[model samples]
Target: MALFGFIGAGNMGLPLMKAAAATFGKNEVIFTDASKERSQFVSDQTGIRFLTDNCSVVKQCKNLVLAVKPQFFPVVLNEIKDVVTKDQIVISIAAGIKIESIKSMLSNSVRIVRAMPNTPAMVLQGMSGICFSEDTFTDEEKEIIDRFFKSFGKYEVFDERLMNAVVCANGSSPAYVYMFIEALADSVVSYGIPRDKAYELAAQTVLGSAALVLETGEHPGKLKDQVCSPGGTTIAAVKALEEYGFRNAIMKATDACYKKCEELSNK
Candidate 1:
């Protein structure tokens, strides 16, 4: 039996399936997409097996991953609900889809985990927020869950109540960061720097700054203070950022993101 059987092989599903294959082995992972062509493309790319449909995946795998978009969860869960066994755990990466709702859609006995992972998982540097339906896990189950997320990158288990916050903070935050990078690059390019060079410089600075924060364990504000000196260019930029409400913009953007996530959940 396959260790993981993915029901969708779209953008998020594809990278996550790749990560699972890397963690276990290609032979132990099976997936099926609504598009036969997409399944074939992934099969040709990874040499992993592909089943013909979602229910078939349920029968053949020890763990089932509901990787389809949130809007399609009702149909997909209905299709596999009868076949999903209590022995098989269901791990969902669908945004804003609550674990309780999934259990109601399928079976309450179904073991479920809700995870929010961003596009960064494509590069295996993703951060995932995991929430289990139950309060605790068995030793073996814990190992399986850890390997499942850590295959792509780091993971932190959180209360299911915070899953939407997880979506706002990290799962959707990458797009925000990309916009920031693009704006920085555009500003530099307007200053006569080659567009390509400007992007390279801006992206590297962002990458380095994140690495420094992770490595040093210093408060971000402290690090910002370190960069800003009296009568310096960095301080001037900081002042301009404050005057323009840069921090408020990001917080408000995230507020919108969180609202959307809540909206999806309430649907």
Candidate 2:
């Protein structure tokens, strides 16, 4: 079994640990966190070994997952920089932290895989964007990482330059989708639908629509056209949305998210 270690045990890290432990079993995992309580709690909950320090986890596991927030990344890197070695494969989920930045912070000899996984991973329905330098990973190593990511949700390997857009489209889109759901539910509630049932209906509709897009591989507009008859309810609602600037609103929101990602990287 391959040993895996997580350096942060918060929301994002905890889910990954849970999913990983379910696949590889708890014995193959180890972790450390800034919060000793959270570290102990997650270890107890998942039956993984918990260490008191970052270096301790680095020493025990060859596959290291850097799950700390971007703001704390440098500090964490400094803590384990001396202990990280060439054989250790470091997978970083810290958004906007470039692979080159991590390489410079640590030793250039260490293998690194940069990944952007969205909030959906918390619910095990994540879409992750993975990119690594061509020479940094062997076929077996790549397979292992791919398997681990798929165990949680979907994974796509893309050119590193597009990672930021992936952040906008997948990583940050969840919040926008949630907002859309909330607005839809609210509108129905105004029409006398029970608030709770309205939420369920709205959310499930979005879920089903997304599934249709994926399973059928049809253009979304074509799918929408199917729902809307020559002179029907769906088109009327869609027209209203267009009048309300729905497309423009979504584009602006994603653009803002993309800009924020760049800002984070600069910081």
Candidate 3:
């Protein structure tokens, strides 16, 4: 029997499955998807088993991951609800789906974990936020969950109520960071730098700056101050960004993302 069963084989699901295969034997990891071609492709590429039926996956695996889209959760849960045993733990990556909602769809006593993992998992640099249902896990079970998440990158356990904030802070913020990098690159290119070289420089600067923040454990504001010497060119560039409401724009974007998550959860 497979130890882990994933219900989708899309972008996020495929990366997660590949990561799991590193620790678990490829034969121990199985998955199913609506598209047979996609599932077959992943199975052939990774040497993991692919089942045709979702319920078959539930019957075979004790650890299940609901990697389907949020809108499909109801149908997927309904199909597997009858076969899901108390021994099985369901980990959900569907955005905006709450533990309580999942419990209501399945059995109240079912062990459920809701996780928010971003697209960075594709590159093994993901940040995941995890939360558990009222049904508690044993030490071994918790360890299994941690190992599965850490296969790709780091994770943190938090109250489910803060999941939306996590979504804004890490899950959705990567897009904003990408936009910043593109803008920076464009500005340099306008100054006669080659387009490709500008992009490389801007992207490397972002990567190195983020590394400095993590290594130094210093406040970002203080780090920014360090770069802005007395009447320096860096300070002038910073002033231009401030004049264009850069910080406020980011704050508003995150606020909007959080509100949209709330709206989706309510629906």
Clashes of each: 0, 0, 0
The best candidate by TM-score is 1
Q: lDDT tens digits, residues 1-267, model 1?
A: 988999998889989999999889998899999999999999999888999999899999988888899999999999898999888889999988898899998888889989998888999989999888984558897898899899998999899999999998899899988999999999988989999999899889998999999999999999999999999999999999999999999899889988998998998
What is the lDDT for 228 in model 2? 92
Model 3: weakest 10-residue lDDT segment is: 21-30
**Candidate 3 C-alpha lDDT tens digits along 118-237:** 888998989899999888689999888999999998999999999988889888898998999899999888989999999899988998999999999999999999999999999999
Q: Pairing residues by index, what is the TM-score of model 3?
A: 0.96
The candidate 2 region of ten consecutive residues with least summed lDDT is 133-142
Candidate 2 residue-wise lDDT, 1-267, digit = tens: 247999998878888888888887888888999999887787777778898999989988979999999999999999899999998899999888888888889988888888988878878899999898545577877777887898789999889888888888888789889999999999989999999999999999999999999999999999988999978898899999999999999999888888888887776
Candidate 1 lands at a TM-score of 0.97
Cα error, residue 101 of model 2, in Å, equals 0.3
TM-score of 2: 0.96
Question: What is the descending lDDT order?
Answer: 1, 3, 2
- Measured against the true structure, the TM-scores of the candidates, in listed sequence, are 0.97, 0.96, 0.96
What stretches of model 1 exceed 4 Å from their correct place?
A: none
